[model samples]
Target: MASSAIKHGELVALQELDSSSPLFKQGASLRVTGKLQEYCVGTAIATIVDGSVSLKIDTQHLRDLNFRVGSIYQFIGELLIQSDTDAVLQARVGRNVDGIDLNLYHQSMHLQRQFEVDYMRTRTT
Candidate 1:
């Protein structure tokens, strides 16, 4: 039977994992539930890589949900934790499910940044 809560991993605060701890390491699977922050609601999934958070949301989802930053989200998956470097957590993602796609997030971020730059350049005399 499938349980609503994550059985293999432990429930932990996002902030706690965001902090420094020996518990954070490679092969470490953690379950974190917190308000969505930093990413838009369209972000159905997200992941941690090199100590950075990335979203795995799509354009259709973005328009449908219109997610805003600072919203809460739940994360559960494995981490490639490393000392002296940021840990990367691969989140399981799906519609109404938990997970993250790093590649998608990077592409979105790049496009967004490019658009911003283009806008700024065009506005400049």
Candidate 2:
């Protein structure tokens, strides 16, 4: 039987959207944080950057949220990758995350993934 439980957004970095990452699955729910680089009010589109990676965000569903360029924000949404250089996040929710330490967050993200892998290896063995 198919589970009816709602799937929660998985935390992901923009860099993880590359071809090698498991989180590159289509329609996958994801939670990402980055600095807002630009926003087009007419088209309801946003551009956010994390380190050297930048991603387009479709903000049609999140019209209520205010997006200010140069502010840090976190977005939870569905991922859509059309090509190697084209990836968009259909954002469902977003909020400002100013004052967040991105460097520490990146380190924690790496540690979390390492722990998950180690835990899975133990379970399988």
Candidate 3:
């Protein structure tokens, strides 16, 4: 049966392994989930997942979240965990989210310095 969750360091298949042939032979899809968690570097979302929290990520560019959440999103990119026992969703790419305990939220970290940053912060602070 297909699992509905992922763990901190476990590996899950976000995309079909049979698809990426030859050059891009990434081990069973890609370990983007764990790597992304590492990539964030001390981000709360990743930390939460490690602690069995829930999370989500904006994957419009990933061609996944553009469709659905959870089960549907699983087909887009990749979900990973260190082991099968851990009940945490590690979405490598998607909007809705799943697996890990924490909701792995993901938004485009746009360096929108040119998109009017000062005006927005000034109003909030």
Lowest-sum lDDT 10-residue window in model 1: 55-64
Query: What are the per-residue Cα lDDT tens digits for candidate 3 across 22-104?
Result: 31332233332322332232342331122232233323244322332122123233333333322223344433334543233
Candidate order by lDDT, highest to lowest?
2, 1, 3
Give the Cα-based TM-score of candidate 1 against the true structure.
Answer: 0.42
lDDT per residue (tens digit) for residues 1-125 in model 1: 97565436554444446436655666666655433444433444443222243422222222234334444444556666545455655565212223545345446656876998999999995
lDDT of 2 by residue, 41-60 (tens): 99988999998998888999
**TM-score of each predicted structure versus truth:** 0.42, 0.87, 0.19
Question: Which runs in model 1 stand beyond 4 Å of their true positions?
Answer: 1-7, 18-20, 40-67, 82-85, 93-125
The Cα local distance difference test for each model comes to 0.47, 0.88, 0.32
Q: What is the lDDT of residue 35 in candidate 2?
A: 97
| Segments of candidate 2 deviating more than 4 angstroms | 1-5
lDDT pick, better of 2 and 3: 2
Give residue 32's error in model 3 in angstroms. Answer: 8.6
Worst 10 residues of 3 by lDDT: 14-23
Off by over 4 Å in 3: 1-53, 75-125
